[model samples]
Target: MNGILETILVIVGIIWVIVFLLALFLSPKLSATKSKNGGKK
Candidate 1:
């Protein structure tokens, strides 16, 4: 039971890390697009 919980926790942690990294990588491009589109809407 404990081992199962630990594996689940590790999987969740890895997913969170991936999401954080994708956001970090794409945010600049997102911002650039927003600015190019005039910063609103």
Candidate 2:
């Protein structure tokens, strides 16, 4: 039971890292797009 829990935790941690990286990578692009629109709104 303990081993299973550890494996699940590791998998979740990996997924979290991936999502964090994606957010970090895309945030600048999104900001750039907004800026490019010249904030006319």
Candidate 3:
């Protein structure tokens, strides 16, 4: 049970790291895309 819990925690941590990195690295790209639209609907 303890081992399983550790594995799950590690997996969640890895996913969180990946999301954090994407947000940091790709935020500029996302902003650029939105700005190109002049914030239109």
What's the TM-score of every candidate structure?
Answer: 0.85, 0.72, 0.85
Better of 1 and 3 by lDDT: 1
Q: What is the lDDT of residue 37 in candidate 3?
A: 85
The parts of candidate 3 lying over 4 Å away from their true place are none
Model 3: colliding residue pairs: none
Task: Rank by lDDT, highest first.
Answer: 1, 2, 3
Q: What is the lDDT of residue 30 in candidate 2?
A: 84
Residues 1-41, candidate 1, lDDT per residue (tens digit)? 99999999999999999999999999999999999999875
User: In candidate 2, what are the lDDT values of residues 1-41, reduced to their tens digit?
Assistant: 99999999999999999999999999888888988999443
RMSD of 1: 1.2
Which residue ranges in model 2 land beyond 4 Å of their true spot? 36-41
TM-score of 1: 0.85
- lDDT per residue, candidate 3, 1-41, as tens digits? 99999999999999999999999999888888888989553
lDDT of 3 at 35: 87
